[model samples]
Each structure stands twice: as C-alpha cells, then as structure tokens.
Target: MNKHGIISLGEVIVDLIATDLSNTTFQRLLGGATVNVAVGVSRHGIPSYYLCKLGSDESSEFVKGQLTKEKVDLSFCSYDFNKEICSVYIHLNELGERYFHSYVNETPDEWITAEELDLEPFQKSKLFYFGSGTLFHPIARKTTEQAIHYAREENLKIAFDTNIRLKRWESENQCRETILSFVQKADIVKMTEDELLFLTETDTIETGLEHMAKLEIPYLFVTRGKDGAYAIHKNKIEHVPGIPVNAIDTTGAGDAFMAALLSRFHDNGVPNNEAELTEYTEFANKAGALSATKLGAL
Candidate 1:
C-alpha cells in the first residue's frame, strides 16, 4: 500500500478449465482480468498492488499463494473468514475455444467496502486499472467507484477494461449503461472488437471507433485477435499488426496486451504521436500473441 506501482481492485477467481469435452477433467488456474494484468505488470519489473478481500478456503489460499509467488504486493488486500473465492468452470473444445459453463460462489454479496480502502495506495500508484467484473455487485461497486474517484482526484491516470460478463449482470441494457458510465471517466480504455460494437450499438468496427472517438477518450484500443489491434487518439487511427502464432489457448491474451501497453506507458509515458502509438502497440501485440501459445494465463 505504501509502494508506487500499478494498483487494481476486483475479484480474484480460480478457473477450472476443462481438459476434454467430457468436462470431468480440469485444470485449476488463477484467473481474473484484473489479476492477469497485475501479474503481467509485475513480470515487467513494475511493482503491482492488488486490493481485495480474501478467505481461508482452498481456492482463496491458492489465489494468495499465486499472487505472492508472482511478487504482487498485498498490503492493501484484506481477509474474511466467512467469504470464499469465486470459482468458474470453463469448457474447452478440441479447437481450444473456451465457454463459461457455470459459476460457483459461497458469498457473492460479501465484499470489501469503500470505507475499508486506504487512499495512500492510489496516491502512490502511477495508474489505476479496473474492469466490469465486480461492478455487478452493489457492495464491490462502491469500492471500485471510490478507488476510481480517488485516483482521479490524485491526478493518476485511469485505465478501464470493459471485461464484460453478461451472465453476471441482470440484463444487457444495465451492463451497457453501467460500463459506458465508467468508460467516460477513463484516460485509457481497452475493449475487444465485439465489445466496441456492443457498447456503441454500431453494426461495424469503423462506426464503433467513430462513436468512441466522439467521447474524446485520450487513449483507445480495439483488439482483433490474430489480426492485431487499432489505436485511436485525437481522432487519428493506426492499425498495428499482430504477431501470428499457433494459439492453443487464448485465455488471457488481452490482459497480456493491456499489461505490456501499460508497462510501456509507465516506463516511457503515454504515446503522443502516431509513430509512438504504433511502437507501443507492436510491443503489446507480441506479448499477447505469445500468451496465447501457452496453456495458462500466467
């Protein structure tokens, strides 16, 4: 909490990815959009801090151990005996495509409150990264909102990733409305092509980018899997080609790209010109493509 680095607040979950179509055999991996970004940033030699409420269950212990092993700072993290870490059962087909089969949680309503958070970490960190995963829960939403306001008040750049999970929200309209509200407050925002279309209610990617450009977001990226990504700033757009790889699993590729991009920003500051934007995007593209070649997110 006293360190200066990237700070992220959200749920820490374990993904039970199926090894076969039967869905009986599985492999447990530390999984969450925010967690992946934190670990990836730490691997880039940046001190990363995580804020969450952990428990004593096996899944919770596993999450704590993995975060510690990855060298993520946990001074801002809390604990609760009654709570339990969330678990997601994912199904993978022969082609390595993943599907969220079901979700399990013992205490979905229990969450760390905004009053429990310390503002010092936000003051010290260079950036604040958040996603929509925890926003569906009212209790967790308050904490996320507080952290965002604190980061803005302190003049730290805010990064928002619309990591949308429709299953968690009551309706698509609610999810869209809630996410767009946060998107307006971000300095840097990232989303997949599908997310861009969904948020803007546009039929094509070009119109979606155009719609987002009107929001005046300083930095915007729309990732297109193996095709690469697009970077938009000040209404200027640049397409950065992606690195091709024989992807076996694409679990955390976007998180990898996000971490690499933020790491570059932390080390060299945000890209101001077209050339600089392409350079940073190219660097992140490689990281993402490489992650897809592996079996796990970490």
Candidate 2:
C-alpha cells in the first residue's frame, strides 16, 4: 500500500528471440510490454510493482528471477500451478523489423480476474501503467476496467501506452475504441506515430494532436522511431530529435520509452508546470534512445 512509484498491470511472458540471422536457434528472454516497463523502471532504481499471473513452470521461474534481479516488487505477482506457460516467438528481419508469434492459446495470463487483484497498491500508487494487449482477453479486460475505475476514484495518475498489437485483438475497431476509452482516463498517453494515426484516424500530426488534445489528456507523446519523438500539451508542440545508433533489434523500444518517461515524471513529481513537463519529455526521449542501443528488452 505504498503511496509512491508505479504499478504495471498486464501480461508477463518469455520471449524466444533469434540471436543470429540463420534463425535456427533462439535465446529465451523475459519480456512483455508492461513487464519490460516494470523491469526498466526497477533498473533505474525506482520502486515498481508488477501485477500479473504466471504459470508455475520454468518460464514463470525465469520471469520471476529476471524481475527479482531488476529489484521489482513481486508481492502482487501470482503463480498458478494449473496454467500453461505464455511464450512469444520473435523473428527479426534483416531490416531490423521484428514480427511476433504468440503461443498463448490457453494460458494463465489470459485468465486473470478482478477478484485476484489487490487494489490497495494501485489505490495508493502515484502512477498506474497499463496498455491495450491485456484487455483483449475477457477476464483481463474486466479486471483492467475495474483497476482503472479504482485508480480514478483514488485520484492516482494514470499512464497508458497504446501498444496496439493487432493480432492479439478481435478487431481493429475494438482496439481503437478500447484504447481511446483508456486514453481519456489517462493523464499521460504515449504511442508511436502509427498507433496515433490508427487511434485518431488523422493523416497529419497536427490533426492528430488536435484530436488527442480534445480528449483532455494533459500530456501526449508520439514517437517517430529513429526520427525521435514529439509532445503536445496546452496547445504547444515540441519535437525531440532521436539519437543515431546502429540498431540491433527494435523490440521493446517503445515500452522502454514509456518506462523512462514515467520514471522521469515520477522523479520530477508528476510535472505541475509546462517547463517541468518539457524537461521530463526531453529526458525520457534520451532514455528511449539509450534503450534502442541495447539488444533486448532490458
């Protein structure tokens, strides 16, 4: 029931990533967008709690070990002995583009229920972070809705990443509607350029910001990959140029960006003024660029 730091609610899984171009073998890595952010926050020496369910299998042990190594709080994380492990296969193309194949036909993460959640931590958390993928599942979707309602009732700051993984959802329209509803509830919303376009149905950045601003989300960030990121708030727009790096795999870059952004904001006391928000955004942009230099979600 700590009153500070962040709580990430979503799925946690093992990522089987091909280390070489031949694609014959792979290295098992711990990853999930929310889990990545949680790990990233812990790496920055921040207090973070990961809220999710995992199977009582080797993959689950691996995830717990990685999170423990990162110093993330696992008090709220559960291990279900009867559930199957959730896994993802990452295929990295020559162009550094990563494609995902999820092996979660019937998994524990997909069965998370609202009753299984403990609301005390979230009610007292300074920031509650979540995204779109988990909501694709019925139980997780309901649980997420309840968590959002509780966060709102407690006046806790909400940060949402519209990490739209189309293959995970039922339909594109459902994704947009679900994401937009969460966006309206979030005080800070971060999305890539494509995600923003998809959510807003706007062709231009100018029009996109206009649409997002109408949602009354105090701060909005649009990441442009290697080109860097942009921010919009109070009718002001600013662009932070990206740093050049010989890219390896571009996986988890956005989640890292969100984690860094939230950490910076939490460190800066949630940015009461425009100057503070600008400074936090710039710093986060740098953190994201730094993350891209790394090979994995770490």
Candidate 3:
C-alpha cells in the first residue's frame, strides 16, 4: 500500500435536501463530512480512501456509485446486511442556512468496530482524517481511537475537524471533552468559530484561540461563516476574508475547506515550514469560498 496518500474514516449518508420550502420537493445527495471530504479530495486529483460502513441497501448502492464515479478508493468500506441505510433530512432557511434531522438511530455506519478496521492503510497513509461526530457511538468511537493510535505509531499526519453536532451527543460537556481529546491528537485541527466557542467555553475569538493555545495544539484554523477564516501556527495568526457569493445552500462548505486544505498539504508533502503552511492555508481558503458558490454538497 502507498504511504503517500490520505485515508478518511467516518460516516457516509444520503442527504435529502429540500429544494423548495413552499413545496415537498427535495433532492437526495450523497454527503457526510468525511464522505464529502473524500469526494473533494478525489475531485482535486488526490489519491484518497474512504473507510466507512454502509448498509446493503439502495442508499448504500447510491453512495458506492457516487464514490466510484468520483474515483475514491472504497476498498475499505464495510457493508452490513442487517442494518438500514443512514440518511439526513436537510431543511434550508430563507437565508440559505441549513438544519438537519438525522435518521441514523440504527444504521450500519454507527456500528464500526475496532476489529472491523484494517489498519494497514492507516499505517501507510501520509494523512489520516476523521471528524468528531463519528466518536459518538461506542463501536465507531473505539474504531476511531484504534485508528488514531495506529496512525500515531506510524508517524502519519492526523487532521481532525471539530464537526460538533449537538443533537448527536449525549451531553454538551461530553462532546467538548471528547472533541478536545481528539484535537490534542491531531497535527492539524479545523473548527468553526461557533464550535471553538463551544469547545473553549469562551465568547470571543481571541479568548477562544488563547484557550486552545493553552492545550498546545500545534496548528489551528478557525472558520467564521461569511466573515472569513483564521489560521494560527506557533504564536502567529492570519485571517483570510471570505469571498462574496450568493449562497443558495451552505451545506458542505466547511467540508470542502477541509478537503482542500488536506489536499494541498498532501500535495505539498505536508509542509514543515511556516512559508509552506501559509501558502497552503491561502489556497485552501479559496477552495472553500468556491464551494460556497454552489448549491449542492459538492
């Protein structure tokens, strides 16, 4: 196996996005934070692998087809015959903001175990990516912990997104603690301003970053909706303003940002210097801005 690519482990689900609020029209799109990142990396012509569990159903087939079409390696995707497919009902506000109603109570993606994971790819990959949401379930949580340990042992660069979904966790404190633990493990950590507030228990961005800096997190990127994004390394911080666009749906913009950031890092051989980091962050911010211009989760 090649040790120069990326491996993303987490959930993948079908998104039923409402096309019209006035009517019952909706469009089903294959999306999950990890899944979207995989597709985004593939679209950027990077070698990528998606590690997840899918049900033996139509939604599973649809997801597989999309992964195949995008040229993402799905050799590690596990399938379970007993469980139903996972899905999310996305409702968009008039301002283009989105909300979700998840139908993943009994889905296979919530059942990924440590024994089911093949750590060979994690050992070989240059980068390993995962989000905080998958750590909610016991089976998937154990699998994630195992994978992170293996990646650390192999000296693979780990990137984590603090994609905190409040509805999925048992309690706010649990989510914060769990996500902070994972953040401590990551070589690069990405989170939105709101997520940072939740994680650090601070109201302002300066105080939030200060709190995270105390954790000794080497690299941190804070995204602020339409305002822009901020990147911090060592003691230096840089802010990149967001591009203006008529966002019809802000569904996968953050995932797009992460994918582009990782893809750039992967392409640049995981920069070891400040100059390289700056270059990558600028390019990644642009990729994220472009994603917001589109309607779907692409």
Candidate 4:
C-alpha cells in the first residue's frame, strides 16, 4: 500500500466507434471516461490503479488485456461471470464531436461493492478520481459513495467530473441532484458548458458561473467544444483558447485533459495561486487538444 499514488473508480466499457459512417463499419476499442483516465495516467508514466468490475464475456477479457497492456494496476479490479461487458456505438461528425448511437444499458460495472476492492489502496492514494456515470444506478451509487466516504476520512484530495449521459439516468432532475452532490465533495470539478448550465439550472453560461461561484467551489474547469476551455482559478475565471486540430474523434478528450491535470497535481501538488492554476489549466487544455488529434481514448 504505497502512499501518494492515484486511483480511479468508474465504468469500463467496450467502445464501438464508427470510423466509417458511410460504410457503417466500426472499430472496437475499450473505453469509458474512468477507464480513459486510468490509461491516460499510465500513458503519462504514472502507475495508476483502476477500481472496477468486469463481466463474463469476450469483451471483458479484451478489456483485461488492454488494461494489462496499458500497465494500469488492476489488483483492485473484480469480475463476474453472470454478467456481460457493456458496449456503445459512438458516431462522430467531421468536427470529431461524438453522438452516441446506442449503449448496452446492462453491465456489471456499476455493481461494484466495497468488499470487492481492497480498502488499503484508498488509504494510500493521494488523490481519488470518479465521474457521474456511476451514479446512474442505486448499487453503483452506493458503492461509489462508500468509496468517497473512505477518501474523505483519509483526507485524500478528491476530483470530480460531470460526465452526464442522459440515457443512463431516469430523469434530468435526478442527474442534476447527483451531479451537485458529487461536485460538492470534490476539491476540483470539471464540466462542459452544457453540464455547467444543467447543474446550475441557468439559461446562460455566465449565469451558471455566477451561481456556481456562490457555492464556493475552490476550482472549476468548463470545457467549450471548439472555443477551448475556461477555468476558475483563485476566484477568477480565465478562458484558455483551444488548440486547432483536425480531430479524428473527440471521445476521450476530456478524460485526457483531466488525467493530465491530475498527473500534474501528483507531480507538483495543487496550485496555491491564480498564476499556477492558470498554467495548469493551459497545460491540461493542450493535453485534451492533443488527444483529439487521434481517435479513441488511447
């Protein structure tokens, strides 16, 4: 149980990306925001641990091989033969923006339990990362909250992402409530402009920012599709311009950005000033931009 390490908790699914829309062909790959972050950190030369569950299917086995190949620590991962690995078909526009066509709603990823994972890892990790996807189901939400409770007790730094998948939740209100609940517990929160508006129940991005600032969220990052991203650093919001790239698919870009930001957190610790936070934001924006230059989470 090494202290000061990183650990990510969330879903790991098989992403069937539509590489050729005209031909209706697909390129299968393992992806999920949480999984992307795990791989992203490892790719950046950090040995991160992933906590999740796999199912009793071929896709699950493939996921195992990929995680092993990525050099991510899977000692805390669990498996179930009764369930099948979930999947999704993502459609991409010329802009590389994603439109998910279909998702396998049934998966064992959300069934994660506290007893299934070693609690020692939580105590040893310096930072904990999780997304809103796991809040879709009661079982998953309970498990995730239990882990969050542990992180809190250990005084581990927490980072949360508002990765809203409307299809996963029953209602928009439920999603909003859960989103706010998790963000409240995080030291830093990342969201797209749309997600920010949704959580704030505001009509404009400015209005949303105004409302969120009242919540006293220490640091915030809002991603704008092509306009790049904005960040609230030391109580001041600054816009970081986007890096131009002929993106192949923008599937895992945010995860890339987050992984880079958190890896920097691991390297230099959290920013104590606006200058330092802005520098980190710019670096993370570049990491996301570079990810869009390629396809898939890898």
Best-matching candidate per lDDT: 1
Q: Flag regions of model 4 displaced more than 4 Å.
A: 18-26, 90-99, 106-110
Candidate 3, residue 25: how far the Cα is off, in Å: 4.9
lDDT of 2: 0.80
lDDT by residue for model 1 (147-180), tens: 9889988778899999898889999999999999
Ranking by lDDT: 1, 4, 3, 2
Q: Candidate 1: which pairs clash? A: none
Of the two candidates 1 and 4, the one with more favorable TM-score, higher being better, is: 1
lDDT (Cα) of model 1: 0.90
lDDT of 4 by residue, 82-188 (tens): 66777888887777566878877564444778667678778778888999987888877887888888888887888899999987788999999888987888887
List the candidate 2 regions with Cα displacement exceeding 4 Å: 19-24, 91-104
- Report lDDT (CA) for all predictions: 0.90, 0.80, 0.83, 0.83
- Per residue, candidate 3 scores C-alpha lDDT tens digits across 242-272 of 7777776677889998998998878777667
- Alpha-carbon shift of residue 216 in model 1 (angstroms): 0.8
Better of 3 and 4 by lDDT: 4
Error of 1 at 29 (Å): 1.2
* Candidate 2 per-residue C-alpha lDDT over 1-298 given as tens digits, one digit per residue, 9 for 90 to 100: 4577688998877788877766667899887799989988887777898888777777778877888888888887666787665777877688756667446545534556788888777765788899887877778889888888878887788888989889878788988998898788788899999988889898987788788878877888899988888877776788877878777757788887898898887776666776776777777777777777877877
